[model samples]
Target: MKKTLIAAFICSLSATPALAKTEIQFWHAMGGALGEKVEDVVAGFNASQNEYQVNASYRGNYNDTMTAAIAAFRSNQQPAIVQVYEVGTATMMAAEGAIYPTYQLMEEFSKGFDQSDYLSSVTGYYADQNGNMLSMPFNSSTPVLYYNKGAFAKAGLPDRGPATWAEMEEFGQKLLDAGYACGFTTAWQSWIHLENLSARHNVPFASKENGFGGTDAELQFNGPVQVAHIEKMGEWQKAGIFSYSGRTNEGSAKFYSEECGMYTESSAGYAGINANAQFEFGVSSLPYWDNAIETPQNTIIGGATLWTLRGHDDDAYRTVAAFYDYLSDPVVQADWHQFTGYLPITYSAIKLSEEQGFYEQNPGTDTSIKQMTSVEPTENSTGLRLGNFPQIRGIIDESLESVWNGTASAQEALDRAVSRGNEQLRRFERANR
Candidate 1:
């Protein structure tokens, strides 16, 4: 009877199932090599714990991923986490109950979470009016100048990037004289030329502190500084010294192919540029117009942040909080900063990278960080909060293209862009309100 009872107990134990882990879905927009890195990071996080499993999915590019999230939210199938680009900040902020603010998420589930640990320049972009962070900053980057060192040497120019717009023009001429078909090219035309340009010059891209004060702000980028820069770029386009690539990152190919001697693009482009460029390249701070301001203000960031969405259970949110904690580790962040060209979002990650001598070994890797923290960000330079900014960017792109192709003057194009963009802002205001 004892043997039979023991056998029955063993059978019952064998029939019982082990506790299943909570699965969390994270949707992101990082593609190509960056996509692989995201998977690796997610894998590391998964390996670190057994209570939850995180499945990272590359939905598409930034806009597509954000659209998917919104659609999913409407259908009651949103993921726990979604990566939304900086341009989508205003849209996400106006989503009301659609998102769970990162600040609140951390406060509720994380222990000893300190918001001050993150870089202010980065977190400031995604923060609410009260200074609470709305989304978790990730893959933040600022624009910088990338020069072909080999091409510079061949052109008999200095081994450094141009410091000012005038100097850049001179360098472009020299590069052209040296037989380069294109002297310089830029990616994200509106972003690099108008948005960052206004911020660096301490000019308002829009009224009411660039929309941070209220949603009723209007576009103001047609000011003197912005007009002059675009006019100069138009002249360069006419002279064949500047190549007008598409509105997005299509200009990167012009640089990678060594047809252009200088390129202005996001610091996050380091990985791809490093992989493709056969010749040596150097990174420098984004060039400014000496006449714009005596000293340039800090530039704004252009990258995506992780926003925790609604429609998930508390257990899933707890898992997300745990994953965020893992992501905040200095070692993990440092690795990300080194491998990718994105800024280390936290001060500890910066220190850890410094200790590891990453900045020393990889020259110019800290250029973006330096440019972003070069000065105390003013009301105009902190960041933009304009609604429908992505569509507004499309307007700016069309306007700039008209100038580049010689169909419109700088002032006219910009004036038109401002007028059209304001309409977008008004529509967004009415809808969101």
Candidate 2:
């Protein structure tokens, strides 16, 4: 009887399961198709390992996610990771004690991380003054031209996109003459027309190297080049060659609906435009000012990156680092890039895509990569690292809306934006200091 009871106890002990895997929460802003891709990436990671499980929560858009994460952190319930848009870089950088630098985390936990493998143009935007990466470059992208090939063919315009602003204007005029609703429209007017325009022209968007040098930097976007460009856009609006779509990617609908022949938007616009457009379309490099004194420089990055928040356990940090390393795999990076139209963040990923002939098979898909990496990034072209940039973008949007609606001239409107933007910068400087 004693031997039978001992055998039963041994059997029960052996049948017990092991402990659950450590859970790591990731709060992000991606939604829709992009959100699905995020889930796939996380699932792949979870399947590849048994020690950690990442739970991804869609917190809303970029602004909303940032706001939510900030609230969560203050309440000591922050996620292990948060994805913040480029506009929030300065804000994140300012939150020194609340976040973990990705470089240190990678070095301490990701045994295979190679900082040198990352593309400079993509990493530079999120790096410190000494070039140490502060966040993982998850979905870096730049503005590009998305045009309706069918509309261009109907207008007797070049099937390929225009290379210069003058060419773009001429194309717009021809498209309008051919009975299109409008020649062109844009999605992110402030980003595409002003911020990137200044960078592409190697002109200063703000003092102190576009605010990368210091918080004391003031707005310098109201200069002659910017004024001339805005004036030209206004002229196009008046001539019916350009239509003013509502702010915040509202113009994408206009282009996809074939109301406009051309659109300047984030290269990530590919997925949505491809999904919606009935007519054939092509992606191309952003048009530049051909008459500028200096040749057009590289455009700046616009997408968000993943940031590791502080206060997590060592185990969670290690898991977060492992996930970061997983995300940096060449195959994973290339798949994400091709799937979403974001630039490949790592050189290995770009080379892998080339090895697979992804670019050749899909014409014009490499437009964003070429536009970003063709030239060495100058100080002006590296990127804007301004604080309170979201608010500044709002101010610029409001001011430019007045310009588009003929309530004010471009120069007058831009002057007002600069004046208003400078005050915001001052506030950020004070708060951060």
Candidate 1 clashes: the total is 0
Give the 10-residue window scoring lowest on summed lDDT in candidate 2: 11-20
Off by over 4 Å in 1: 1-17
Task: Return the TM-score for each candidate structure.
Answer: 0.96, 0.96
Each candidate structure's count of clashing pairs: 0, 0
Clashing pairs for model 2 are none
lDDT of each structure? Answer: 0.94, 0.92
Best of the candidates, lDDT: 1
The lDDT, on a scale of 0 to 1, for candidate 1 is 0.94
On residues 220-337, what C-alpha lDDT tens digit does candidate 1 reach at each position? 9999999999999999999988999898899999999999999999999999899999999999999999977899899999999999998889999999998898888899999998
